[model samples]
Target: MKALILKRYGSLQNVMFEDISKPVIAPDEILVEIHAAGLNPIDYMIPKGIFKPILKFNMPATLGSDLAGVVVEVGSKVTRFKAGDKVFASIFDLGKGSLAEYAAVPEFAAALKPDNLSFAEAASVPMVGLTSWQALVVRAQTRAGHKVFIPAGSGGIGTFAIQLAQRLGATVGTTTSTSNMEWVRTLGADEVVDYKKQNFEDVMQGYDTVLGTVRGDALEKALRILKPKSKIVSLIGPPDGAFASRRGMNLLMRIVFSLLSRRIIRLAKQQDTHYSFLFVQPNGEHLAIIGSMLESGQIRPVIDRIFSFENAKLGLEYLETGRAKGKVVIELKDTTI
Candidate 1:
């Protein structure tokens, strides 16, 4: 099988196409004939040695987090799906091998693709879609009539967050550049703040939840927008317990988190708010729920571009620019064929 392998962690130049042995299925896994894979920032970041503390990987590893394809073979212990089943999955584990022509994914992390979407579209959903779902529904417990503010609303996760929040009857607000304001509105954001022209902190208020996608100082800004007792969920690691817990740092991190949380608790006393660091886990059940939403036309993927399999490195470069409006897909074979 052909795969894009990283010989060493660095830039796009490190990614090379090579023939590699196809993955053999584990008892709880299924071998999928990958049709398309989604490119995420993590794909590029991981090889640069950013996530080294959390994920230990061997060199020549394939890098891709999401996949959409047909199941070719099922492990003996896999009862959830069988051969010929079309599936979509968040393959964040198992060596991130979705960039290959085939991949073996745990049965629990793979869901049947929605009837309404194409393979490429299905590929785009697992990571960002699940991130939005987990942060809003699972962590924040966002409810109808609640107010949610999502930063980077025109980006991958933001696009899904805006649509899902709106579908659940939440009043959604988001920040993006002026060029993306109308696009964010189309995704169901009730109020779109042009980040380039105005300060969202000045005019936005009373948000029940603020979903953070950008890191560093932007994350701190998100914490301030939430109403008293409201929650803030961020994907970016750093600050607080989530990053420490994820890194498997020592108990010192626990003590640090305890002290930092006390300060946040004090702030909440003044404004009545809460905060959490959300790291989305792989859940096939959650993917199924998203599939239903797609089939019902309640939500749709926002795709910025589709590159040929040979051009996956190019897709990585595109994502690195931080300018893509939505998901970027890499098709293994031309569907028109």
Candidate 2:
């Protein structure tokens, strides 16, 4: 089958289409005939070797993570799905990718795609969904009456997270361009800061949780917005010692992460807030719950565009420009090259 493969790390120039053997499933995995794939910021970042130290992929490896498709075959131990089942999944850290004719998905990380969502929309949910769930609900413990701040309301994670945070019953605040302020408000954000006109830290304050998505010193400024004892979970991170520990890195790597995050940790401590870095993990059960929300209309996908499978690199280029209002996706078919 023809698939997108990474020949080297550095730039998208390294990624191209090539013929590769179709995947053979393990006892706990299922083979999917991919129809669509989601492009997250991380998808572009990987070519720059951002996760080289963590994920183990061989040379000329396939490139992608989130996919929506039909199950063509199930593993011997798989019971949740069978041939011809519609499913969506995040294949991150699973030693495979979805920008291909087919991909092997672990049964534990695949969920029935919501009947209401097309394959393109379903493909767009995994990374952002898991990120929001792990950050707001699992780590920050956002609840009714809590004030939650999530910056970057126009981005993929931002759009989904705003809705999820509101559903979790937190008052959500977010930052976007002037044009998107009202757009984000429609997504349930209580406070929308037009970043071109207002510095968020100047006016926003007293939050119970902060989901850090923007890079640079924004996370630092966010500290002042939180009440004492609030929680901050950063997806864009100078990863902390805890993250390194969880990844089971060597002592040197843990020390390196500790050094890198020392200032942020110290600042959080002084402000009486807890700071932690989160790398979203794939979970089928959580996707099932998120799927229910999609089915019920409590949440809807915010898709900026859908590119053809052949134009995935162009889609990645467009997404990297930081202009997309929501998620970008790539659509394919069983007959696609």
Candidate 3:
């Protein structure tokens, strides 16, 4: 099987194709024949060694996290799925990747693909869906009458977050280019900020929650938009101490993260707002619920482009450009190496 694998960290140029043996599953895993994969910002970051300290990988690691595939074999401990089941999963932080012809999926991370979606669409849901579900529903506790600000409203996380917030009855506010203002509004954003013409902090106020999708000063600026006792869930982060403690990092690393996030922490504290960083975790049950939402048309996959598996490098290149309006997918089954 040909797979795009990292030859070394520190550069995307190190990622290349190689024919390797198919993965052998453990008793608690399923062997999936991948048909499609979704590319995220993290996919490119991995090869750049951004997550090296925490997400350690063996040499030549496969380079993707999200995938939709058919199960060729199931583990003895897996009861929810059988051979030939169509499944989608985010195998992130799992020490393996999905950008290969085959992957070994743990039972806990595998969910049946929604009947209403194509393989590429199903592949696009897991990471973004999980991130939004955790940020808005689990962490922020967004509810009816609450106003939630989600930046990058037309991006992968933004598109899903807006719809999910609306489903939870929260009024949504988001930032997008002028062209995508109406696009995000249709995704359920009640307030749209044109980041070009106006700074959101200047115009949007009294929000109950802010899903911090953009990096740098955006999270701190978000503090201005929220009311006292509100929450900001940062997806892009100089990760906070809470995240460090949850991941069980060493004291040295925990201190490093603390120092990294101290300014935002103090700024959030000064405003009486709660700020915490989020790392999306994979859960099949959560994906199942999101899959149901996709099937019901409560939310839809926003795909910007689909590249043949042979052109996956181009897919990653395109994603790295940060110009895509939504998720970018790479199809595999009918594509050549």
Candidate 4:
């Protein structure tokens, strides 16, 4: 099997397209002939050793997090699905190996693909869908009539968040460039802030929750945009109380971050608001529910582009631009069932 393997942790140049042994299914797993795979920021970050401390990436890694495909063989314990069953899932929890012709995924982390979607569409659902679902529904307890603000509304998670938040009856507001303003409104955002032309913090106020996918000062600005006692969920790093001590960091830098985070933590306590730094978790059950919602027309997959398997590098480059309106996928050409 040919896979995009990372023999060393460095830049994207370290990634090599080479033949590797196909994965054998575990007793509780299923072998999937991957039809498409979705790219996420973590896919690139993990291989570059940037998340080395927290994510614990092993050398010679294969980098992909979400996939949609058909089950070629199911283990004896896999009663929910069998050969020829179509499925889609976040393979992030199973380890990063979805950037290949096949992957052996644990049965519980995979779900039946929605009947209404193509493989590319289904592949777009797993990681960002899980992120949107967890942040809006689980963590923030978004309910009907609630007001929510999601940043980067036309991007992968924002696209899903806008739809899911609206489905739960929350009046959603999102920030995007002028080019994507109408796009997000179609996704159900009640109001769209043109970030390039207007500052969202200046115009938008009083939100039950805010999902921030931005970094630097923009991330700090998101905290100010929320109402008192309201929640803010950050997908980027450096939020209050998110302490992950790295090994053998210079004492000076450690002390500086500790004091800075402590001050932010204190501020969060004073406002009576909660803060959470989110990394999505895997759940086949959640994907099944999302799939049902997709089939019902309550949600839709937002795909930016689909590249042929040989052009997977171009997919990664496009995602790196931070301007994709939605998920980008790499499509494979194996048609056998």
Cα miss at 114, model 3 (Å)? Answer: 0.6
Whole-model lDDT values for every prediction: 0.85, 0.93, 0.91, 0.82
Residue-level lDDT for 142 in candidate 2: 85
Query: Can you write out model 4's per-residue Cα lDDT over 1-337, one digit (the tens) per residue?
Result: 9898888888888887988898988888999999999888777777678767456557778889899999999998888999999999897846658889999999888999988888989998899999888888888999987889888898888898899999999999888998888878999999789988999888887788878687667656666667787887777755233333433455565665456467545566576677666768888988898989999999999999988889888888889888788999889864222
- Stretches off by above 4 angstroms in model 4 are 239-263, 334-337
Best-to-worst ranking by TM-score: 2, 3, 1, 4
Model 1 global lDDT (CA atoms, 0 to 1)? 0.85
After superposition, candidate 1 runs with Cα above 4 Å error: 242-249, 252-270, 335-337
What's the TM for model 4?
A: 0.92
Residue 194: error of model 2 in Å? 0.8
TM-score of 3: 0.98
Candidate 3, residues 1-337, lDDT tens digits: the string is 9899999987778998999999989989999999999999999988888888768898978899999999999988888899999999999999888889999999999899988898989998899999999888889888899999999998988988999999999989999999999989999999999999999999999899998889778987889899999998888887877788999999999999999999988998999998888999999989999999999999898999999888999999999999998899999984221
Error of 3 at 92 (Å): 0.2
**Least well predicted 10-residue stretch by lDDT in candidate 1:** 260-269
| C-alpha lDDT (0 to 100) for residue 267 of candidate 3 | 90
Model 2 Cα lDDT, one tens digit per residue, 113-214: 999889999999999998999898899988999999999999999999999999989899999998898899999999999999989999999999999999
Better of 2 and 3 by lDDT: 2
